[model samples]
Structure formats: C-alpha cells, structure tokens
Target: MNFLTIFARNLKQGPQTEAFPLGPAFTPERLRGRIEFNADHCEGCRICERVCPANAIRFAKTPDGMTFDCWHNTCVFCGNCEFYCPTDAIHQTNDWDLSHVNADKFDMVEHGLIPNQKCVECGATALNTAPVIKNAKPPLSAEEYTELRARCPKCRAKYLKNRKVPA
Candidate 1:
C-alpha cells in the first residue's frame, strides 16, 4: 500500500494531459491542411508530382499529353511540393473541409474540371476549362435607356421585337 501511493504520486508530478475535442484541439496557425492552387500560375510542370510522398498530386493529360490538373484530396500536406514550386502556383491552406459523405466526391480529377464546353466567342470546345467568364456585356438596366428618340424606326422595331413581356 505504501509503495503504490509513492509510485502514483511520482508519476503524477508531470503536467496533466488535456482532453482533446472537449478540452482543446492541438493545432497551430501554420498547420497545413488542404492544398491551394492558382490555375493561371500553374505551368503544367510535373515537378510537384515527382516529389510528392503520398502520390496525391497528379496530372490529367490531354490526348496530346498536356497536363492540366492539381489534385488536392490525395495530398499529404508534407509541403515539399509547395516549397519546390518554381512558378508559385501551389500552396498550402489552413482549410480542413476535406470531409465528404459520398465516396464519389473523393474521386478528384487532377485539375478537378468538367471538360468539353464551348467558348462563347470562338464557339469551339478547345477552350473548355475551369471557371469560364462570359465576357459579354451585362444586360442594360431599363433606367439606363431613358432617352428621347434613341433610334430611328428600323432600330426601334428591332428593339421592340426583342423586348420580353412581364408574364
């Protein structure tokens, strides 16, 4: 009984361990989580692929063997690729929203894009890529067209024909 008490007291001399989740999650400001990417900055160089420990990042090659991908889910957050990026295209973010209910969500594409779409101006599928911006001018507000005799009969007839009804 005497030996047990002394042994227990000595063991407890160190700091008490705090309970995680309930107490506090141990993390830091610089803790790495999800990998970040800049599509325009990426030069399609495979330097990141060669150095990845987890084989997380990969390239989605086109038929002509052009790379256009930056997979984030399989990435291990080792920061090796981020450190070695010459173009500064890839970096690590603190985001931890990698959880998904569907298993299909984890089947990430290298660039995570839906291909084969037409470019508005060119009308070709070649320019199909991520985050397309329609460069066309925004529809003019009604108040913006408040003017007297803005156009001749020919122009007014065409404009009236294109006007949408409230119904």
Candidate 2:
C-alpha cells in the first residue's frame, strides 16, 4: 500500500497494454469497424445513406455519376449501412484501427460513371436507375419495359404532359 511499494510493483510489471502500431492489433469478433462498399453489387438505392443514424454516409449525384461516401470520423460503427443496404453492397469489416493524423484517412468514397440506358424513343440517355430498370419486368411487358427503361427524362416529361387520363 506504500507509494514506494506501488512504484516498485509498477516498474516490475512494465507496460500492461499491448504494443499496438508496432505489434499486431487485435479486434473483437464481429467488430463493426469500417464500412466497405461493393460497387459491383450496389444498386444505388441510397437506402444505406438514408438509414445511417450518424449521417456519416453521404450520396452526391454529379454529372459524372452518383458517388457514395462514408466518413469513419463521423461513423459510430453501428453497422446501420450494412443492415439497410438492400443489395448487400455495404459490409462492416474488422479493421478497427482507424487512428490517423491526417483527416483524409477517415474518408471512404466510391465513384463510378453512371450506367446510362439509352432511350428507345429518342436514343437519349435514360434517367432511371439500374435497379429500377432491372426490376421493371413484372407489370410492363418485356418490350414495353425495355423501351420505358431507355426513355430519356425529356421524352418522359413530354409523354406525361400529353398523356390523357380518363375521368
């Protein structure tokens, strides 16, 4: 209980913590660490971004395409993105060592050129998302759905404007 005794004991025990950053880092099983996005499997539903509690997930629709970004600094690692991803594109990895001096290290972003389906009517780019085009098979016939999927935004607007609805 003496100060000298305590100091001696501390000296004898040395460091009680693991030497991380120099040695192997350990993470717990099922550690919701970093968010991983698989663009191949992603349907761009934006559901993950919508369901994120921390607002760490962000989506931007640019001229090039839609980009999804996740910030580790803002993320609480709750795995909400993974849970809400309808396409199973988002995943929680076991890499919990997120420490870094540079703030840019915390950013995870995925960007790709928009997959445009040409409008069958005018050969213009279709405004529908990939998932929408893929899932548009049941109600509309195959040919009609294909044409609809290829319809451009301008053409769609014009069609809607000229459409006659029965009272």
**Model 1 alpha-carbon drift over 4 Å, by segment:** 1-27, 63-67, 107-167
Worst 10-residue lDDT window, candidate 2: 130-139
The sequence of per-residue lDDT tens digits that candidate 1 reaches over residues 63-141 is: 5434545556667779998898776778887766566667756555445332343333334344222211123134335
TM-score of candidate 1 relative to the true fold? 0.45
Task: Write model 2 residue lDDT over 72-107, tens digit each, in one string.
Answer: 778898987888777677899998777776756644
Q: Backbone clashes per model, in order?
A: 3, 1
Ten-residue region with minimum lDDT total, candidate 1: 127-136
lDDT of 2 at 92: 91
Name the runs in model 2 displaced over 4 angstroms: 1-21, 103-122, 126-167
lDDT of 2 at 73: 78
Per-prediction TM-score, please? 0.45, 0.58
